[model samples]
Target: MNRTISALKEWLNPDWARHRSVPPFEAGLRPNRRLDEGTALLPEAEFEPDDVVIRDNGEVVFSSGDGIFTLADGVVTRVATLGGQVGTLLVAEDRMIAAVDGVGLVTIDADGAATDLCTDAELAACVTDLTLLPDGIVLATIGSRAVPDWSAALVADDRSGRIVRVDGSRAEVVAEGLGWPGGIENSGAGEVLVSLGFDHRVERRAVTALAKAGTAVGTNLPVYPGRIATCTDGWWVAAPYARNRFTELLLDEPELLREMTATIRQDQWFVPRLRCPDPYTDTLQLGQLRVHGVIKPWAPARSYGLAFRIDQRGRIAEGVHSRADSDRHGVTGVASRDGRIVVAARGFRNLIEPQKDKER
Candidate 1:
């Protein structure tokens, strides 16, 4: 049969064979090697948080789907409602700036007054993340203006994402033609680092040379990088979804991927997802057929959660991981406070904090 011959040819190909040997899911595979052994989930809040930042007053500010909330003493208080899916939050002096999915960048005051910050037509797309610079400017990452569905954009290989700088009412594109720029941060010395999700790498560029091409920093990451945050020693990078062999193998089989995307429902497809509540509905993604009364947590996963710490030079120093069996998946953002690492576990819908050590 033609199908039999095609399988034989694929197995004979050296590259395909090597990649095929790498199992799509391993029984006890933890990429970070249990670096998150002591990490504990924090108290639940009213809504799921996407991003978190430490205010000048030491209060923690986070952006949920519908509003911006502040967390203190394990209590969450809604400070402002953006009326849209909030992506990222930044506290500049006394002002609270946020990037709303359906809306553009806006600044919110203490009394919940919202004012438009960047209204440039080009920057009105899905603003994913933002960071405050030392010079009082704000840098934001736009995923794509053409495709609202980020999942579709990734599979379609949409390269329309961009990075922009916002100063007062003026906005300028710093970099363009990016493949889903998910996170932005100041990388010190007037340079900025951005995480390109679909590209599976991080890039750095100077603020002055906005038109210049970026220098790749973290290359060929095993996971799709989401957000990057600065810490005392270096940077905390969030890897929302782990690498899967099926997705990796499809990188060269564009036609197959296109057919799958066209034929399958978006939610049922074998793409990385942020949340999966019903295990039965996700069996297809697990690359398995469900037998009666036989569901396992360690089932194969197309997505997992991971975070890593990188040095000032952008080299990975340490990491944390949640394997396929774990519930703590989809780590979209990370922050550090008083030596405690806080993670926005988007999949689990809870913030996670590692148990404090008395020695530190």
Candidate 2:
């Protein structure tokens, strides 16, 4: 690990970002998709996939502004990306909820109504990820990730991160001091498990008083455990990388993790930024240079979409399972239940348009 970090440092040069190429969508100011006539599909139908997920029965749910597609065994069966850029999707009880970043949270009933449960303004109160808790409360992560200086970078946002609990129309702050909470889960026994992205740690909180329950057995396990899932085992975590590698952390070794967390405090040597900024904008100093460094000298570029085990324990270490090159663009976010895995690719290009008018 030390050698890798040293190598990265030695190869890091001021000209690194110059050779990097920023994606076309990210280089422009347009949202990935625009609602010209209230129709979901665009005229060109070029909006790419942002996220994906799996249904309870084994259907793969993938998102793109063009439509939401349901895949079975890597084959597309149904597509539904209309009226929103699907940022995240999760199975909540009998229905599914799809979060449309700056738009609003939509609850798709078994019949698929796509009812708006919470709008952009309501969610702006700080809800990033949402999950239905047992007792009628909707558990959500309400945190802000720092604006990255580079593109396609997997580092955590350190500015502001938090957790929230929303019951019907009421909301409450549950936890804070986290590095951009990305994924959330609730234990059957009133414990909420959260993934701290920047910190690369998992933590639990009690529901009653919203007090700190405990840090996950493992700490500093990986750079970005994208999502958290609960299964028959213990707790499952997914870590995505630029090499398109996905790793699932099995918490079955509770004793080993507990001991490791208690003693390990020194920060691990992490790779520096490796993405190029917009080429048209020379204002972003050394942005392109960094990209050149990562591709030319640092190493071949790779990205991990998502990885995790069906069971939370060591019973089965599900290898990194996801589409290759899925991380090339907007792909991120994953959730699993039973024997299924759901991947979500958020369209970060056009989060929300300034000209978009709120429904009156």
Candidate 3:
């Protein structure tokens, strides 16, 4: 009922500024083959990964499936098994905190012993990312409270997401009613920047008073931004999925969206994903239109890979891309290691080093 009214309002007088406007790939956010032309770190793994973090000891650790793995001294090994899907990862001194899908937030110490940090019910589902502040306050993002899955929350326009503060073995939701807080990062001034996924912006939130509305730091994003990590100069942000005109139109029609959600397979929905659906079985769009035996890289694609750097003032500084014709799509996680941007290309099922120049 409520969705129908919202849909009516959108259909009757569509406000381009309110929802459908996407920033063009120009200026600092320009598209490039940096992502597609990069090299995968662990091609042997061949499994989708979530978030990544570089430890104080220079080990690159990442979450995938039910385990946390690390790359140290040119070798990859499983560090811990949390018995559930792991998403976000945070490095704190000799310990690492991870968001386990069904088990809640767990911390693994240097000895590889795992312990539950926060068992908050709100984090049982979509725990996206985590960050630690200068004052030692740890914050995590719950992508949605109303629905467990991202696609369902996106289609329903659910704004039940939150920013959770971790204190010892307990956690509290400091901010609520957010349109999918996809990532959280400390701004080095005692404040934090949050990536609101469905909202398509990065917001600056006060850690001392999070229940209040935050100030938008970055807006007019062309994609649904996710996990944010500190880079050499500023910050590295990952945009896991690009906006599609066809999908945006579906959002404007509640009945059609509901019908498609109820009838079609989720992977085949008109929504964006980490990877594209099988071409032979999915609905065809002109974006995939090939001319002269090649699909242009700038063509509107269902799945897109993007990891960009943003300045301190929240302006995009530079970006890497895997466009329509590239198989290296869905850059969901990002981190900086040895002057190179490390990307967790979930669609490609491996970590990629997408930076020029060499330090080794």
Clashes of each: 0, 35, 0
Instruction: Write out the backbone clash pairs for model 3.
Output: none
Q: Clash pairs of candidate 1?
A: none
- Model 2 alpha-carbon drift over 4 Å, by segment: 1-49, 72-83, 120-122, 125-128, 145-157, 209-213, 242-302, 310-318, 321-331, 337-360
lDDT of 2 by residue, 1-360 (tens): 654554576589644322222221111111211212121222132444444555667665655653565655434544454465565566777777776655556677766566767663545433446667877678777546343222212232244566666665455666665666667777667777676665556666677755464646445442355556665556445444332111112122335445544565412112221122232332222222245333222222233233444234323244332222112222245545563433342322211111122321
Better of 1 and 3 by lDDT: 3
Q: Rate residue 82 of model 2 by lDDT.
A: 44
lDDT of each: 0.73, 0.46, 0.82
Residue-by-residue lDDT tens digits, candidate 3, 1-360: 876676788788887235665668787777788877887788554668887887666778888899999987668898899968999888887788899988788989987899988787867878899998876668888888888688888999999998888877678878899998888888777677889998889888888888887888778788898999887678889999898777888887878998999999887788888887464454556376667877678777878889888887778888888878888888889998557678888887888887573322
Candidate 2 Cα deviation (angstroms), residue 286: 14
Best by TM-score: 3
lDDT of 2: 0.46
RMSD, each candidate, Å?
A: 5.1, 15.2, 3.0
Candidate 3, position 99, lDDT: 91
What are the models' TM-scores? 0.83, 0.57, 0.92
Best by lDDT: 3
Per-residue lDDT over 110-227 for candidate 1, one digit per residue giving the tens place of the 0 to 100 score: 8888888877776566887888889898888888867857778867879888888888888888778888888878888998878988887888888888557689877767677888
Least accurate 10 contiguous residues by lDDT in model 1: 20-29
